[model samples]
Target chain A: MNIPSKLIEDAVTEISRLPGIGKKTALRLALHLLKQNEVHTEALTLALTRMRQEVQYCKKCHNISDGEICQICASMRRDKTVICVVEDIRDVLAIENTNQYQGTYHVLGGVISPIQGIGPEELTIESLLERVSLSQEDEEEPIQEIILALSATMEGDTTSFYLAKRLKEKGIKVSTIARGIPVGGELEYTDEVTLGRSIMTRINYSTE
Target chain B: MNIPSKLIEDAVTEISRLPGIGKKTALRLALHLLKQNEVHTEALTLALTRMRQEVQYCKKCHNISDGEICQICASMRRDKTVICVVEDIRDVLAIENTNQYQGTYHVLGGVISPIQGIGPEELTIESLLERVSLSQEDEEEPIQEIILALSATMEGDTTSFYLAKRLKEKGIKVSTIARGIPVGGELEYTDEVTLGRSIMTRINYSTE
Candidate 1:
């Protein structure tokens, strides 16, 4: 039998569904919300509600947005020719947080994983191709680059290879970001300076 | 200047307003949501909205509920004569997780903290007293017992003392849970078995 009230139990169940939050953590968060003043709890509830109502996918690049187009796609300052393709919007935020990338992003939504039943058609690959075809104004210039900034997992590799082949057929220069230890994730498995240097002197992927 | 889109920034800002979440963690959670499927995202958002719209405080016990009375207050199996007084609904969950307590709960909403300007008047103390006065039956068996299961903190102690005095005039038996060292909070400062022994040989407080 359930020990907590149905309301509390529902909140805990929802919280536990989040990544990294276990049953104990969910209970803690639920209880904390309960202790808060009605106004405070109301604000949290409103934010959660509005996050759904307001947020949407950018029509152009498939990145997260509050409108028709993502900020990156809408911005005139970003390099339109150099599109960094990633697995999800989290990668968009990760690159954005680095303050190192100036190109716009294309969120693939997820990687192509046969094991997971995710194929090329399942992603926004068609939209990406359509966006790449938008070079009609300057056909001679061609798209300068398509950077594959996908994660360094097996699925990410397979997806990158698939994307590279598809983009290469359209005569676009496709390049995968170097595979190395992540800044986060598991760290004790890797030595410190080696991981940092791997990031510094990364190699490009090539069929040769 | 804000680093991300205004709506995304605003969402993160609002999420960080919760008790333990910081800006970094809020960003992580927001990015995680942005990466999730729209259906999953909508579920979380809806849960938050429903929490505010549907959930209410139990008029009788001050505990959280989706109706006028919480399920604990509504349950027939729970012992109504015995009340377990706690600092918050979180404490209620903690006790409930043990599966040892069969009595219903009364959430204080918070402990007494002079520094934070929180006192007896700010809590559900008056409601608790009213509950006691009205609960007495024709048989005159008295409201058997009240368990003061507040935390072992200084503020918790102060609140228990204040509550004990208030209940004593009504001729109700008030008891407090024992305290010495916590189960896991800063264990390096405590001896091994003392904490274990404290849990084994708990003494009841006699509010005479």
Candidate 2:
């Protein structure tokens, strides 16, 4: 694309550097910005720059936060004894939206993926272990359960297995979220591996 | 949807204001930027801000440019006697990519769309007429042809019809690009209107 203006070309180049946006989409976005009010463009630029400059990671859970500790970790009502481990902040947001879980979260930042050269040490695993150990010092209510709520991928499974092995030595109960056919899913459409797991882990149904 | 950090939330809100970007995609983009190097985010913000602030419009052709006059209008190699009138800069770029058209262009900025509350007065149509009338004053090489190269949409058709009526009174040759089944398009799947037009405007074939 022979873009006429140097400014437009530079903007399009920068925008196309994003993950899923291509040159065409970037051009469209640049044009759209051109058509919008100048204040809108200023707000977008300011928000992005401020977010990058001022954003902080929670010291306790390693999730994104504006301060030292995240809101979820600082909240007294949340069940700190049962920490739900997630791969990233997006999962925390997803689970938080459900509003079913009352426990806090430990964002791993990412799962263990040897292909990406990311290992257990690169993540927040060490800090999580430290948190668990510190909880043991509190004799009143020690850490009881650690829920592994990572994705259902190979990297997720490997990280779960590694964490479970480490947590078991500290006498902490380790559990994983159940995997099966999703609610309202048809049996015939479910994949074979999930269907087999669902059948093997089938629980006794009751109308109570 | 429950973003933990205020910075992330703000960034998502601004990013989602862009055309075709939803809240989920905005969140993903914000997180992606968070994961990237700080310099990348800075560069993106700077590029967007500078582009919006410093960009200028061409005086002669109404196309986007870094200077007063666009490159095509300022170049001596381009034919000044023929002007291809387009709806926007994107169409100018598209035509330039073909490398076939040697004439300059007049970018109308947009078509006449009553539904969108856009009229001829809102576009650069008056400036185009002024250019043609000025060319008549030159006396040596006046604008010989005006190509109505707008899109095939109803708005484009209305604008083209209006321009052709106005330009014909000035005794300048007016033409439009032909529409037919696209090259490599299957005849059976082509729409009725286009297929009928293609047959009505069929040209003679010769072995020479």
**DockQ values, each candidate:** 0.34, 0.87
Best by lDDT: 2
| Sliding window of 10 residues with minimal summed lDDT for model 1 chain B | B1-10
TM-score of each: 0.76, 0.94
For candidate 2, what is the lDDT? 0.93
Model 1: per-residue Cα lDDT over A1-208, one tens digit each: 2434566677677877877788777777766665566677666656655675577788888887777887788898887779999987668877888899988889898999888899999999988887787763577535689999987778998888888988888888888776567668576687676578687876667833
Tens-digit per-residue lDDT, B87-162, candidate 2: 8889999999999999999999899999999998999988999999999999887999999999888899999999
lDDT of 1 by residue, B40-135 (tens): 766665665566556678887888776788888899888888899998777776788898988888989898999999988999999999889888
Interface RMSD, every prediction, one decimal place: 3.4, 0.7
The clash count of every prediction, one per candidate, is 0, 0
What is the Cα-based lDDT of residue A74 in candidate 2? 90
| Whole-model lDDT per candidate | 0.78, 0.93
